[model samples]
Target: MNSPVASNESLVSVENVEKVFRRGSEEIHVLRNLDLQVAQGEFLALMGPSGSGKSTLLNLIGGLDRPSRGTLRVAGEDLHDLPDRKMAEWRARHVGFVFQLYNLMPVLNAERNVELPLLLTHLNRAERRQHVAAALDVVALSHRAKHYPRTLSGGEQQRVGIARAIVTDPTLLLCDEPTGDLDRKSGDEILNLLQALNREHGKTIIMVTHDPHASARASRTVYLNKGQLSTEPVI
Candidate 1:
């Protein structure tokens, strides 16, 4: 596949990327010369069949993994060239992840959970608290700051997860099936919050989802199939 022409405004650029996993004597190709571009502050939804590499693509963009062969750049930095330590620092400063399971610490309260990411930064305790408070407020969970994951509803717990993701005010938000575990009403609410973050907070977001309804909320949607990208939906 030909690589997409990256514009100056593009925040993520993946060109001729390939990812292969080795299983002893065999090699499994997950992505094959895949190309994609995401503009700054753009909300993009990636949809595909199971094992179609949607999450793999998301992980690469988030700097959680690297492609076996290709070039990748995010926010003007060459992700493909960064060392492990540099990559970790860059990821901590620029990328935020929202998981399907919330992934909160079982013993931590909402406030403490949201403050976890800030501990890696140079900020003081007071600064971390202010950031945590603001993030909880954004999710409208300020009143539940002391609530633990087990005590909160599924929707509220997801809100806390979102607060934790945005606590650093990251340059990019990578969500993997963020609403997959919620009911319809709760899912819609989460979608609305994501839209608000994109439109108001100017956060660049890339979401992987199987639900067409969830994908509809994004600014644009793309399909992945057989390790390739297409604008048309995959059937």
Candidate 2:
């Protein structure tokens, strides 16, 4: 795989990474010696076709899955070497995820949903509440704190998802097609929020997207094809 331009202060460093899955007797290769470097405070857009291993790569960087071969480092920790339990702890502290489908619990109100990640932390109830409030405010959804997911608009639910992701103040934000399900206007709103998070708050973000408009919001964009990183999309 070809390497993108290197960063001086890389928060994510993927070197010769490979990911594979097994289905019965068949071996599926999803990533092939991929190499990437994401600088701190950089908002990177990862573009690829369906089944191009974009989400798989995001999963690896976020410590949700392990690479089959080679080094994977994020926020200065070697994810490839961590045990499952340790990896879980590391991920909770260092990674936040925004899914394409909102992924909010139907029963929980906005604030409660945002507070979920803090539940795994050592913070007390009051402390968690403080964090949740600040996060909701960041997303401009404090007014909807008591509103459940079912009561909110598609865009509003995504805001809640963003709030939940940032409540932990994670080292990296791994977003998988975060705006895919929203309309153009709503998608722009989410992109604006993400841009503000990167520029004003210095949050490092890696977004997997198929839309060029979404990718255009990023500081840098890279393409993935056949499990390899490239400067141009493979056709």
Candidate 3:
């Protein structure tokens, strides 16, 4: 696969971004003047201690939250300027998120869970089924398609989550502690799957994680602290 980074095309660009949350008279500044660029097909990892705004930055990239200041562009769309409805639509079409806790609906089986993202699209039933099946195949979880979340192992459930995330073939993937809730073995399995997606499928991934081992798997690792980015080369 061609290296998107080598091509020098940015899939996500954040410049002088800040996120501030206000509660009553108090204000919490999560991210301050953060600038980052993720090239297409690059798997970038964000590392920071708790409250360092790592997850906040990921949410901004994924369009889950708007920055209080500065500009953010993902997949060529000006995320900061998009109306709520437009942002939701853009997110459905361009971004896929993998969370630490498998956010699968308890009642939905693996195949059904994978099919949820397609519900936002106009694809017909047949098309949706085809995409769901292909996503399950990508995660090698086709055999568990009929199993409910509770019946599946933690690893299997997370695989189903990955299947759901990729079913849309979104432009980029935002992962927040994707391996955080699993055991060591299961976590490694999840990381391997993420790596495969980035390497073989040309997926651009931005993952927020505290684990050094997880950061090592990404093409580049960036550090955040005190609501600011540190360009110090990763050792």
Candidate 4:
């Protein structure tokens, strides 16, 4: 694959990327010469088979993992060039992650759980509370802000996770099977919420999903197979 060129509005540029795994004397190739360019504030859905490296691609973009070869630039920073410590900090400031499971602490209330990201910054307690309150409001969970994770429904808990992701106002939101664990109705709510965030907050969302219904909600849907990317715009 040719290296994906960065356009004027590009937020992410993936150039000739490849990811390989070595096991004993054998090597497994997950991504092979893949190319992609994500525009700023674009909502992209990544779909593929279970082993097609969708999560690996998201991880690369989030600075959670590195590709074996090639360049990945997010918001003008070379993701592969950052040191581990700097990468962690960069993710906190620029990237937010939502996973299939709402990985909230068992003892923390929704407000505190949403405040976790803000704690890494210099924000005082009142500032943190303001951010959390606004985030929860965006997801229509303001009424449940004081409830513990265990006390909320699955959809509510996931909404809390979404609030936590956006509290810091990250430019990029990366979700890995965020609705995989929810029922159809609950999943639809989550999808609609994500769309609203993208439309209103201008978040650069890259979501990985296997479910067709979930992917259909994205502005653009791309398929990955055998380590290559195929784009199909969704009307």
Candidate 5:
């Protein structure tokens, strides 16, 4: 699926971003002077050992958390300045999130689960249904629209989660360990789906993963080490 987004441009920019957690008199810097830039429609992966701050970096980019210092911009908006209310709006309009846990309501059917994000918007019911239907179709899960989470396999549930992430047609997709809980076959399927979403839909994707194979699928891979990105390459 080719992205509907226009020309190649800087969709996300991080400049000297730093995150420091102060506990008592001690300070823990999760990210130190980090710098990253993502072009529109590009797919990038962040990888590192546990506690390397890959997840912290992803959270900062997604507006789930903020940096202690530095300029972080996404979709032309400086994230450091987006207040809580405005950040919520920015996230709803410009960014989509996918998690390893396949965060879905157990009671909701696939379609309804995909519709959850739309509830945050002003889109009417008819428009919302169209968006949900299209997103599911894109993921080839329209057939499972009525199925509950328990009825679907792990892969299917994850696909539903992906659908829900893309239903809002956001420009940026931020994923945290998307395949951490899946079997090889299911993880491969999910990876292929994400590639399609990036290439065909032109969604700029930033994914964090421990799997080398998974990271290899991305156009570029960055390593987070000791609170900063490493210039060294492991491959």
Candidate 6:
């Protein structure tokens, strides 16, 4: 399975984390006192039913949202401590996100879409193109660089999204139901690509998925229920 041994140098560590939301005069707790650690180079899967707070936990790790309480340390930075602007900057540099919807810009071609995150960096135009090309090549989509999202198939579009996510070589790859919208064949292709990224490229990935088949590919699977962890990770 190539699951990594637990160590102190965890890439992601959530300690006593809790999340709550309020509407009008009522308060709802979403997550309660959760703790987790994902070692470097590990591919961890979070699985649960709808509204189980699986995505919420993924968001906290990806720096897309803040925890209402507790500490979130990812890639050695305390995400809970970073200000909004700094968090954005940190996310740009350290985290890559892949969504189920293949959030590509309809107006932009594949290469341009992959180049979006690099624009936030100090890379020049030429450098950005080089990075974009490399990323597309990694995903075996170099031939589709000039194609727009609307013209590509669902799997191809998701490949572009994957390319976009990895272009920056971020420290962490966060995937939220990355293959949710694809056919079984296409979803398997994407999962294979993600597996290659983890095993070959040594990318640290945390994926949220409901498919047990998909979760089976991960090094470990953790289940969440009712906004709380229901069981220890299944190997």
lDDT of 6 at 83: 95
CA shift at 188, candidate 2, in angstroms?
0.4
**How many steric clashes between backbone atoms does each model show?**
0, 0, 0, 0, 7, 0
Candidate topping lDDT? 2
Give each model a TM-score.
0.95, 0.95, 0.95, 0.94, 0.94, 0.95
Which digits, one per residue and each the tens of the lDDT, describe model 6 over residues 1-235? 1222244589898999999989988988889999998888889989988898988999999888899999998877898879999999988988889999999999999999999999999999999999999999999999999999999999999999999999989888999999899999999999999999999998889999989889999998889887777556433
Candidate 2 residue 181 Cα shift, in angstroms, is 0.3
lDDT of 2 by residue, 100-218 (tens): 99999998999999999999999999999999999999999999999999999999999999999999999889999999999999999999999999999988899999999999999
Cα lDDT tens digits for candidate 1, 1-235 = 1112244568898999999989999998999999998998789999999999999999999998999999998877888879999999888788889999999998999999999999999999999999999999999999999999999988898899999989998888999999999999999999999999999998889999999999999999999997899999987
Deviation (Å) of 228 in candidate 2: 0.6
lDDT of 6 at 231: 54
Which consecutive 10 residues in model 2 have the weakest lDDT in total? 1-10
What overall lDDT goes with each candidate model? 0.91, 0.93, 0.90, 0.90, 0.89, 0.90
lDDT of 4 by residue, 79-194 (tens): 88799999999899888899899899889999999999999999999999999999999989999999999999999999999999999988789999999999999999999999
TM-score of candidate 6 against the unseen true structure:
0.95
- lDDT tens readout by residue for model 3, 1-235: 2232345768888999999999999999999988998889889999888899998898889998999999998888889989999999998888889999989999889999999999999999999999999999999998889999999999999999999999999888999999999998999999999999999998999999989889899999989997888855334
lDDT over C-alpha atoms for residue 153 of model 1: 88
User: How close to the true structure is residue 172 of candidate 6, measured as C-alpha lDDT?
Assistant: 85
Q: How much is 186 displaced in model 4, in angstroms? A: 0.6
Candidate 2 Cα outliers beyond 4 Å, as residue runs: 1-7
